[model samples]
Target: MNSRDDFTEATKIKLLALAANLCSRCRVMTVGPTHSGDQRNSIGVAAHICGAASGPGSKRYDPNQTTEQRKHYDNGIWLCYSCSKLIDNEETFHDANRLKTMKANHLAYASTLVGVALMAPFEVKNEIRAGIIEATLALCGSGAGKLDLTAVLEGYEDHLKSIDPNYEVEITTTNRKVRYDITAKEGFVPSISIIPSAETRSLLFEKFENLRLTGEDIVIPSEGIDFVGIDIFQELKKTNPKSVIILKSKKHKIESELFLESDKGIFSLGSFQSLLKGGKRVQDYSGRALNGLFQYNFIVDLENEKGTMEFGSTIASWIGKKLLDIKHLPKLLKAHKFLEQTSSYKFTVECEIGNTTLKIPKGIQNQPENVLYFFRRNIKALYLLNEISKTLPIKVSIISPVTTDNSIEIADFSLLLASKPQPERLEPGTLLFNSRLDELPTPLAIDLWCQRENLYLSVTEQYNRTSDLYGNLISFPRWNFGFENFTPVLYSSIDENDRNYIFVNIYSNENTTVAFGLENGNFELL
Candidate 1:
């Protein structure tokens, strides 16, 4: 069925002119010049305000709308590729009303800009230029203010690493400032630099949060110590009357350093190894004995608004809490540990007779969800077959990629099972045939996506009838496939009346390619 009510070419051009070729949400110029004099580069989409198709995945899809209404210019809005996907992905937040309002507001703003350009006099050119400069500066500063510097740096580092796996990016905090140290492969340097435009600085800043200083005055507490003893504080003060001594303790290792405060910022003096512990015990300080084991808990700097702690002394935990801190670090630490720990569950049949289960040393537990589902469906078939004839011996085998290093992952597993089966040699990328006449045709070939996305992964090029669909013909079950360190690549185009379409090329082990199309966020046979 031709259910899509795509906008006409005229309607798309009208939308472009109406929005001044600017994305309604981002205000980015979507149409620009190309190297070819006769051609222009357009990254704009005449996005449907109410989805062209009626379905749950369709954003703001209206069932009552007629084909004419659905395809009309009034039902469309201009947007950039990223903004279009964002609105569809977050449809609840960007509802029909909200999208309409955004479009209306953008049109109004564009009209005002046009009016100003037309009416502004030459006498006020300087004033207008100054105003624009001031506005630009204000926008940049405000955009940067709303960003988390650390996150920006981390995202930038991730991007750099993705472009070149050999690239190494590290975020370091020292001298009261956070900086990024990116190292490419030996004898090579990356040409790309993270220079953000005025409009994009906000986004880039957010993504590269790991690059910037947190401006957090974090203090790693001395395990059980409370307040700094007045005697020890005075002793350290007497040694360096103009500087504060900071002892950074981590994993029972402490480094004593002197920090001199100045108008510009705090300066770190050379470290003094064993300056406090040299020839002295904890009880020799003429203060309460320190007994607990010390470990690093948080980051701190001498540039803290409050005065730095004295060396050979302890700062109260309360004082540390009052200082600036990055509270999410501990949560991030916990999350890292959570990801490291893996677990899984297995399903088995417990009949009045003996329990039927696989006897592999490595049980089905701890396998991927998709693998588990495949085993469950296989078990169901086996259970039914066993009901018919309990005397028949059933043999099951899981085939996986044969690697010389025995490092095949569980996700690569494929099932092979039969009752009273004849032994046959199974080769990689070869079809297995069913010897029994009663058995249905098994799926000889299968192609799985590492990561599934909307409007992608069409197994076949064309299906003549509804029953001819691969899903209906094949007995094989669907599993969401995944792999470690793999990222799916997507291709998109603004073709056919500026309609945005995302395409996926599905490749099987046989080297056959099948293409799929996405229209209005729904998959379509192409």
Candidate 2:
């Protein structure tokens, strides 16, 4: 085991700096308010993608590892505090389904941060620009999908170091200011000059300028070789006030190649005609109104919002025709209660399972109540079985509801056949009661049950309960529920002649299981 003492102070500082940069980038990526609804403080923490517990085993910290072996940037990702803590605990971090969700969240946050950084003022002083660039480079590295000003600074530093044996460099920066210092050999008069590269000068003037600076203060020394300090400072201030001057003649080679490698396309358009006539059509013609008839070709009658009935149709005629063919449509039959209540409709559904009831609002017509019903039923049944598994001598597993289509079932329970306790797994089972299988009961119920009994309940996935058009129902066991797995439960409904759907699923380790199917709603234990 590598102890913390093995990490030098310099290495620790670098790690912390990298962490800070990553955290800032994550915050910028998740631009909207978090679950807490606060926008100002949204930065996430930089977590070791390989888990912090890896220590010396970590690719980032392995001293003996070659640079090429540790080069991939995907090894790290930004995570919120809650997710980070889960990773640090090493409990159960890498679930394929859960990982997909987390990766999407991370990508969204990263993209937002990159955009904000690109638009942010560069802080014209050479030192500040260098510091910012360094920080960005540390977070994203050279292959970052966006522009990195830090790589440019690194090339410049490498060039300067080659020119003098005793050269020293320092960088300072704030939101408003930046400065760079370069010192030549000791015992010799230090050669100090502003960064002389044209690219560097342009970036400073174009991106940094007044956007980042607060005051128009600049200084230059006179009587030096080439451009004197006073003369350079005065000229820079007039042309680009607030610019900071630094040593110029150092062998700092700002590589144009590095500057051009940003993911953000930087090529100029030249002119509109050049772009339009050169390649494929530069504009979209689809969905364009030809003669401005009805606003656009895709326009619908305003009075018939659902577009189920043609414009200028009587409500009575629409209802009469809809009711005549109700048997052919299962979704319409399910929604008959709302359809009969009032012609002016408010999309909503209310369902009851024993004493436990739920009310879902409008706009979720795509999600069918039948699906939710099965989810809630399965969840309740699983909790009940979990309670029984603790005190009972026989191990039990329950299949619960997996889909709104009534084709899948999921179950949860633990069995101990011999003296030793067996690991929990999901299998097909009969439905004890008619209810939704995907929905789990309240957390309080599970906690109370666990404290009272030594039983562990693991509910399986929601599965298809009904056969398709054929009499045979498909049994896909791997789709069974397990802890930490994230699966989507889909439901379908129709409103106002338009069909809608809803997809939902819970993410939990202890209260999940795979979905299965059985004959006549009964399972044969395997």
Candidate 3:
């Protein structure tokens, strides 16, 4: 009864190509060259949107589906191994309808490569052109040799002319040396010249024995650009502000800078020159930066592989009316010598290994008096770190010190734990418990502080000063809370009782206030 219906080989191939060999969910490239550099490696899986079997217990099972329909191309979505298993286990979140939407979104993103960058500058377009040249060079193997250009021109002529009407190809030879040049009439297409290696020339000579290299230019009547190279990174030069460019080149190396042109002016996203220095190719990379706001610095030196990423930022917030709730408010307000600026906070984050450094914009103001609100605003940095840890070993360090300055130091302590923690199990009735902390293998010997009036929470991984790497990259566990930040409105005075209690008002469909008393480093529901 549980007989599985599987996709055809053709369908599987189409699924991978349509998604551009990227997982629909995480958008990580699934196909790449293996370590041997000769064979290809594919981590892609043609996942079933609906259950493959007609069994009642099968996830997202549709009993009405026929065997052919169950195995049809439309029923499949390409995903990585981890994402495929994740969707199956989390059936509710990854329903068939949601998976279909994800498939459509991925296809749409892939289509943008051709649709958007069609008008990019000719010189910039040649980056893609260079990839094809490299691929063709590989076809001929190693060594400098002559290659026939007739078939290659005939195949791509029509497509090239689509981008520029004057597109033409010319192949000539002088003294046994071949010169292959692609040119356009005037501004239509810029002249392109690339000397094929000896091996490429040999293979081309064999492929087209009748073809001869002459001293005069041999022009081919073709007008087009090679769109085949757009799939190199599945992205184009003029990407949207929120777009992320992962280094998934067939060559696995970047030799130029990535930039963006906007109405304001041209701005540099970052450079990839250092990524390919020392003859190393980027083997694996994952992160999200270049989001139109921050300056990016990425270094993917796999050979040396030893470095640290440090990100520092200053935080400032206006001291609002809530200051009246503090115990020393009356005295502080009377002696308010520093009326210009209310508060300033500073902190730094250090990681052992990262592809890039993420900058947090300085002087964030008018923030809600919620401890979690700060984390929410900078969650992207955490996500970037998490993604990098998937392919590289990393350790996190957070440092914030309290000095005898007028500004209040919100950062008094740091929590060092795994970047990726186990599913946090909440102790019963704990209103505010560090869910991820309970799964620690050993008891953490660190100071813990919690204040209600001026909320501050600093959570970081444990700092053991050891070489051992901790944490596996996994999806953060869902929190049982609403999007609106929760704020503690009322608190029992510490002078009144040994056990201090606070009531937090959480916003949701209906406003609800929950009471909690501090106990054993956790806030228990009172």
lDDT of 1 at 374: 37
- Model 1 C-alpha lDDT per residue in residues 192-265, reported as the tens digit of each score: 33333456556445533422243212222122122232233232233223332222211222333323222334
Candidate 2 shows a clash count of 67
Q: Tell me the lDDT of candidate 2.
A: 0.33
lDDT of 2 by residue, 50-102 (tens): 33333543322445434432333333455566655655455354543354466
Error of 3 at 7 (Å): 1.9
Worst 10 residues of 1 by lDDT: 283-292
lDDT of 3 by residue, 1-526 (tens): 5379999899999999998777999988789899989998988999889889865657888888899999999999999999988888899988989998999999999887654533335766676566545543432233224454333433333433444455454434455343434443555533333233454555434422322211112222111111232221111111112222221112123333333222333334343322222223222222222231222223333455433222222222211212123233232232222221324322211222347543221122222234322422333222332233333333332212222211111111101112212323333333442332223222221111132222222233332111111122222211222122123223334566523443332122222222221112211111
All models, RMSD in angstroms: 31.0, 31.1, 26.9
Evaluate all candidate structures by whole-model CA lDDT and list the values in order: 0.41, 0.33, 0.41
lDDT for model 1 comes to 0.41
TM-score of each: 0.25, 0.16, 0.25
Q: Give the poorly placed runs of model 1, Cα more than 4 Å off.
A: 55-57, 115-526
